[model samples]
Target: MPGRDETDILHSWHRNADAWTRAVREELIESRRLITDQAIVDAVLDNRPRSVLDVGCGEGWLVRALAAHGIQAIGVDAVPALIEHAREGGGSFQVAAYDDLIAGRFSQRVEAVVCNFSLLGEASVERLLAALPSLLEADGRLIVQTVHPLIACGEHAYVDGWRMEAWTGFGAAFPAPAPWYFRTLASWIGLFATSGWQLCELREPLHPQTGRPASVIFVARR
Candidate 1:
């Protein structure tokens, strides 16, 4: 079992798949920033990957999108409801912890593994990054987009008092006592290096409307 904090946060966020989907859908619809993700996907999938596994694939949007383009896609999520939601959309769905996902029943010859805004959720960054290579093909790519540590850290505004924000558990509400690990750009690059991945591209996002920089984008190769 993961723990109270991980379980609580997962439960809260995934308790209602529709709500999560709607929130993300609305964010994308209003911002018109899918172009960046699209470009990253296109660049990584230049050779038309035969198998692509979307780690932490929430709600199946990316999996469905990739399948539509004749690529075999599988989405794995930690939350059961999210996995069911992904399965209902007609793609392979696995409800397993990130560490357990690799040994599951799936083709091991994955050409690319996509992690969109997922890996930084209070997990072991080094161990997780290290395991990604075995899940990919020889020339596979690891396309990752995460909340930049600086901006994400900024989200922890000390309201009421100088309190530290933490993940009390999965599906749990915020403001609970938990520890959060925020990484700098240099630290993230170094993490990949230690994890045996070579940096191929770094695509930091600019504020969609204002063109101000926001999050960091990373594309690594095994």
Candidate 2:
């Protein structure tokens, strides 16, 4: 069963779906424009995957982007509103949560599974990692981009724990802020190993203006 934080995180996304879709679509925020978006896209393209599964694909921007490149991509998110928005953009999308995926709700195995800044809690992540083996083709890869533990820590200490998003730039439009677990760089590597994933590559995306690391992208294989 999902814990309190996990449950809240899920609910918060549903509540914030409309606001988030607008923010991401109209603004194309600085971090996304400069770093995360292209980084994830480049990582996927580098693998030349024919089919891709985009987990927690909020608003399906990546799915549409991949489609524009002639790559077939299916996006899944927990919020129906987000999925609806994605469909409106002509992208294939499904309303499914991480638990749904683990329960084998989605049976198609793709060449790549992309989690774009979506893996949140340790328990949920562990379950998702364990389920990946059955969800990917033999030689498929998992591409994950997430908030860098260092940057996410902000003034907080460098440790494995839970952190809440300030949702600062998002303003009052977003009512429920989501909290996510923080795992150190070493912790991330260890989690992959214990979960039966081989960490193939790690990249740190930097803020174009400040030249400071913004997020970390991990490419792994089962």
Per TM-score, the best of the predicted structures is 2
- Candidate 2 lDDT score relative to the true structure: 0.88
Candidate 2 C-alpha lDDT tens digits along 1-222: 225457777887888888888888876466886687899999999999999999999989999999999999999998899999989988889999989999999999999999998998778989998898888999999999988877778888898887787578653478787878889999998998998999999999889888888899999999
Cα-based lDDT for every prediction? 0.66, 0.88
Residues 21-134 of candidate 1: C-alpha lDDT, one tens digit per residue: 554444543322444456545644665788888888877778887888888988887778777767776788787666675454444669988887666444554667887888
Angstrom error of the Cα, residue 171, model 2: value is 6.0
Global CA lDDT of candidate 1, please? Answer: 0.66
The TM-score of predicted model 1 comes to: 0.75
